[model samples]
Target: MDITSPDNSYEIVIVGGGMVGASFAYALSQSFGGTCPSILVVEASAPLSDKFLQPSFDARSTALSFGSRQIFEALNLWQILEPQVSAIHEIHVSDKGRFGSTQLTREELSVEALGYVVENADLGAVLNEKLKVSNHIDFLIPASIQQISPTPGGMDLSISTESKRFNVSANLVVLADGGRSPICKQLGIEQSKESYQQHAIITNITFEEPHNNIAFERFTENGPLAVLPLREFEGENRCSLVWTTAERESENLMGLSESGLISNLQASFGNRLGKLTSIGEKFCFPLSLSIAKEQIRPGLVLLGNVAHTLHPVAGQGLNLALRDIDALVTILKTASENQQSFGSMQTLQTYVNSQKFDQQKVISFTDVLTKLFSSKKLARIATRKFGLLSLELIPAVRKRFAEQAMGLSRKF
Candidate 1:
């Protein structure tokens, strides 16, 4: 709940109360039940009257894998979020103008839905409301961490608000800030980044035909394009589009008239969902693979994009981060029960050790998919063709691929 009077210390302090941070806080609180520790969340931006105006709750939509849905169900959040989501009954993957394509269906996985897509704003509203009602959490907004330093016992932080600045200490600090973090830079954390020299053109588009709850992943000579199904709006069949293209090409696409853009999209995407009727405001950002050099140190841990940012090819970025939150919360809960210092290297290392393989696998999977589909080499083209054919022809191969896409391969 909101705390009017600041405390000098907290058992846990979370930085950046965005999606990741808020999820972690809620999960941690639920896991501990009545014995929950004193938790504080410091967010730099105040909650806007309209969630859509918030940076974290903008027009973007996130594709949550089936496994991610299970995670939310465990947290008791799925019931509240289900109404705002569109379920994916099937995923269609193809190479543009290629000889092979494959489809993954919910029946094959024995699940009702393969995944669900929810607009960021809707998801943010649910999480923020939960934060405000949680008795164990002290929600602090319009507050910034001016400085963070290590102490013998834990970490010390200087927090700034509109009225005053104050010092607080915490046994552990969780950093869920976005990829571009000034605090990380101040703490001398280095990131290894590899730019793909491509920018993703993101916008919502209306189609003449219904999507039938099918998400499409199409690879073209330009780059990988994803069209995720969204709930109908105002009687129009809508879908979220992520089109990756070269830097120059993205600029050209952004400058096109709505009709011109629709024409170009029709040529690239074909008539799978019929004609593209309309386009929304276009947004673009460069693609990259960024991993922090260190995710865990004494008294501090990095979570979400602050730790690793991946390509948007398979829609794995947020799903993977959600899994990370599950693992971290479990480990911290155990530490709390055992009365061990959760911020100690031993405790933090245990969390890292448990998640190391999962993190690497997802990172590698996303990176490889981005590179494989982005290339036009003859050999790579043949390889992908065979890959798709194999997925269709072989049940074992199809099952394995579907598991990864549904985020069931790793058990958190």
Candidate 2:
């Protein structure tokens, strides 16, 4: 419900009501049913309206793994999201100007689709709409957490809205505010960061031919270029593009004319989707691997990019965050059943411990893939070539690769 002023206390307070924060609130509320805890979501930005658009709900699209689809299905949101998503029946991975290439198909995995792609705005709309009407959640938008301090029983938060400022307390405080989190710093949480020294150029491109529900990941000398299929727009075939390039090269690419940019992109992407007909507004951001040294402490926990920010090479960042949310919600439900404090050290630790392996594996996979594919060194190139060849020739290896890409590795 829309809250003008928060209550004095809550069971859980989530900072930042973006995708990650809102998803957790919805999932937690559903999991608890009638015995739901008092949850408050403090969002710094205004909600999406006819006049104002939430920045998080920009034009960019996210590739949701099959596992993420399952999570949303369990939450009863898949039906609402499915209509706006483009299913990926197959993924084509190749090394530009190289002999080795591999393809992972849904038919081979015996699944409906490998993954699904949805526009950020569409997904955000669904989540935000749910938040506004949720009976168990108090969503405070266009508000900020001015200060957060740990208490013996929980955490105390000072929040500021347009007309008023108030203080509230929670048994558990979840930090989902993006990577640059001042609250995390205030709480003395440190991050271990590694800069890839690369920038990702993102845009949507229209092609002459249909994509056939295929997503392409091509490793070029510039960096890893990904073209994921998108739902047709105005009767035109379109796909989302994320091209990772060096710091210097990104500026040059972003400065080119639309036609010039398409020409360069066509040269790198080849004729997979026929001619690249048109391009959208371009966006660029520096790539890096950033992980918080402490994800859980006392009555506080970190979620989303505040916990870990990864390379976009494998498109694992948001998917991993979703998995983390699922695990935390499950653990909290168990704790509630056992009559335990939701923010106790033991409970929070259990949530972190349960997701450690999955988190590590995905982080390592994305980091290594980014380095290996982005490097021009002879040794790295040779290793990747052999890697692709193995994935293509060996059924067992291919299955494992496909499972990871489909976010099913944890199942086995």
Clashes per model (N, Cα, C within 3 A) = 0, 0
The residue pairs that clash in candidate 2, if any, are none
lDDT of each: 0.90, 0.93
Q: List model 1 lDDT by residue over 1-412, tens digit each.
A: 8765569999899998888999999999998889999999988887677565246667788899999999999999999999889999999999998898889999888999999999888899999888889999998887889899999989999999989998999999999888888889999999999998999999999999999999999998888889999998899999999999989999999999999999998899999998899999888988888999999989999999899988889888889889999998999988987889989999999989988998899999888888889889998888888888999999999988888988999852
Give the TM-scores of the predictions, in the order they appear.
0.97, 0.98
Off by over 4 Å in 1: none
Residue lDDT tens for model 2, 195-311: 999999999999999999999999998999999999998999999999999999999999999989999999999999899999998999899999999999889999999999999
lDDT of 2: 0.93
